[model samples]
Target: MRGRHCRSGRTGRKRRQKQQSHVDSVSLCHQPQYVRLMRFLHKQGFVSTLLQPALFSDTGRGLQTLKTIKPGQLLISLPESCLLTTATVLSSNLGHYIKSWRPRLSPLLALCVFLVCERHRGEASDWFPYISVLPTSYTCPAYFTDDVMAVLPASVRRRALDQREAVQEIHSSNLDFFRSLQLILSLPVEDVLTYEALRWAWCSVNTRSVFMSHPSNDFLSGQDVYALAPFLDLLNHRPDVQKSFCLQVKASFNNTTRCYDIRSVSGTPHFQQAFINYGSHDNQRLMLEYGFVAQGNPHSVVYVDTDLLCDALKRDRSLDQKIKFLRENDFLNNLTVSSEGPSWRLMTALRLLSLPQTLYHQWKAVLLGQAVSEEREEWSLQTARTLCQCLLQDTCKALDKIFFLLQHCDQLTREQLEVVQALRQEEKCILGSCLEALDGMWGQRDGLLSCQPDVGSVS
Candidate 1:
């Protein structure tokens, strides 16, 4: 879709063409840069058999199939030499000088440093062609102004703040190294290692880097480590798609090539575009790092602060110890609301924190998945119902506040409004699902209580 939609005004209409022109100028006008990048790829033996980069109206840029790719076709492949990874940076001519700073900098941050240094070099840098095509700006929430950020939900704001702090920390801690490299390379520090430059590089890596398990590299210790696959990154992300390629580092002409050996996971059909899974990331994460949000992310979740529950129970001073217990056990935060309802820890906390003193031990056993008597189960369910209803009420109030802001906040920008609306809608969907699950549980509870023997009819 176009980046912005007109809001039905003469001024808005005037702005639309200007904005579209700017987006196209960056996305479409960079054809020569992209073409040169592909040539660089071909020189390095990174070839695509079935797919090619094509611009679309809906999504700015993505891979379009050149031919009908079958179930087991190797659509694309890239040599290991093509990837701009940590190992690649370490092995570069500048690696010898930069290795001394490695003790303080992370592998990822080291790569960012390499990018900034190379960026300042212009055509002098070996990867200048690849660097030229990198995006000039990002749409991530971290780039949002304070006024725009204030309208976002608490969870998103918290995440954005945390990201800002991280970028600041990285910038501050590496300033000396950044300066040293500038002096060593005889370049201006302001133009090279500025926080803004590092941030752009960081986001570029965050959004596009792919995992590779290079057999030769042992410095990276994880299931798989990330590498910036240049041409591979041109393909836009589609979270739900039948992936038809597998990445492996194979021995190539002299150096190893990170080959995308394609074999369709499911039966392949006539699809216009191809995509690879970028991990099961939620919309919040995608927007924070990648500058985009999926319409209906299956991995989406809603977070209610633990403090909300504490506020709900403020009048009941007797639950203070239970709250303390919850904190000690590390169950007092990230109370997630999902399609399946409140997470297990959340439900357990709700039951335990609200249980009566007499039944506390029984409830604790039940929380631990032990058997409990029918009377205890009935009592627990009743307590759970009360707690769930309270949570539901709080969630609705939260939604109402979002609606109120959207209705009354006249100062929101078109971009800000879009972000707010998307986030609010996603949260509402999760909350609505949670409410449905609560109602179903309540119905089951009523049925259980009704089936119990009537003591009034008994002797």
Candidate 2:
């Protein structure tokens, strides 16, 4: 994403910049592990001569185009042999144990086990080239320390804790299967399959695996849909890519070639980093799954919890009934504020909560987009403004706490602090935007108490 060219600079400066770019590209391309990976991929019938690896100042590792690429050009075609799928695991020595185990392992757990075992095998493993380049440690929330976790917003922190527990439970529940590995492995099974080892393996598979459809396997516990594509995973996500451009390069399994292919929909100049769209994931999801957040992400959002909504709109005894209705209709979840202001779901919930007991019978109409009265409309707007203001204050306080932690806490690494700060900053921006939209709507009505709308009007 950082490969954009500077076209307006002076000719001498441009030439020097180009020279430095060439040097950086060459240095990354010649890295020993990448060199080994390329050779291995070539031997396995994988070829992508159009692209080479490069390190960016922002995004660490990404693929760079070797030449000017044209629209509809095949950027990468990874052969089946190079793909590490469940089929690969089933065929290996580990496959025999998987078949004989009592409780079938989930497709995810199987991949995690394979990665850890293979990594422990060192150079003797066939995937040594690919495995050698993986990050020694990851920054996913599971890897975050308690001090760093304390700085995360309440909702995000809860989800992060759930993720950590899920991984831990997976490891704890599979101890018997791990123990059985003692028969095949040289070292004690406990030494190689510890919780930390499994955590590393799980993060590797979770963050980098590509989706590849596999037929139903009775032996596997979950849906068979994950493949570790060796060189293809090097392509980092670019959240800013236009949807139309992303559509041009279709990625799918090529049945005829038995390879995974990706073609460019638009042309890219030589020496620029080639990126792939990883869907329109927000900064929160990106941080949760991939351990990184995008800057200026269009999909970023600020979540409003059910408790916060209730707290802002607490007015009468009917509050319980309104909350029950909202929950039953599945509107309580996914309540958020974004760059587009409060989501429709949030507005609908607010409208329902603002209804007076005398008009409670018409609650369904409110949800159906009918405005009962100008007073009710004003109430909803006031409640929304109150919620946004509360969240903005909370965000500012969180930022202050983060600054204090950064100054005094030695437990958190620089990368962890930066990630926490970025996530909070993004939430602050979204809340500010929501407040602005609410103010604009209030200004449009001139004076809330005086303005009146026709009863039963549809908004």
Best by TM-score: 2
Global Cα lDDT for candidate 2: 0.81
Backbone clashes, each candidate = 4, 0
Q: Against the true structure, whose lDDT is highest? A: 2
Give me the overall lDDT of model 1.
0.64
lDDT of each: 0.64, 0.81
lDDT of 1 by residue, 35-140 (tens): 7887888898877656666676556676665565555555656777787887887887657666665454566787887888888778888798799878776767
lDDT of 2 by residue, 355-457 (tens): 6667778878877877677777787777777777888888898888878878875543657777888998988888888889987888887458543232223
Model 1 clashing residue pairs (backbone): 1-58, 79-257, 80-257, 80-258
Where is model 2 poorest over a 10-residue stretch in terms of lDDT? 450-459
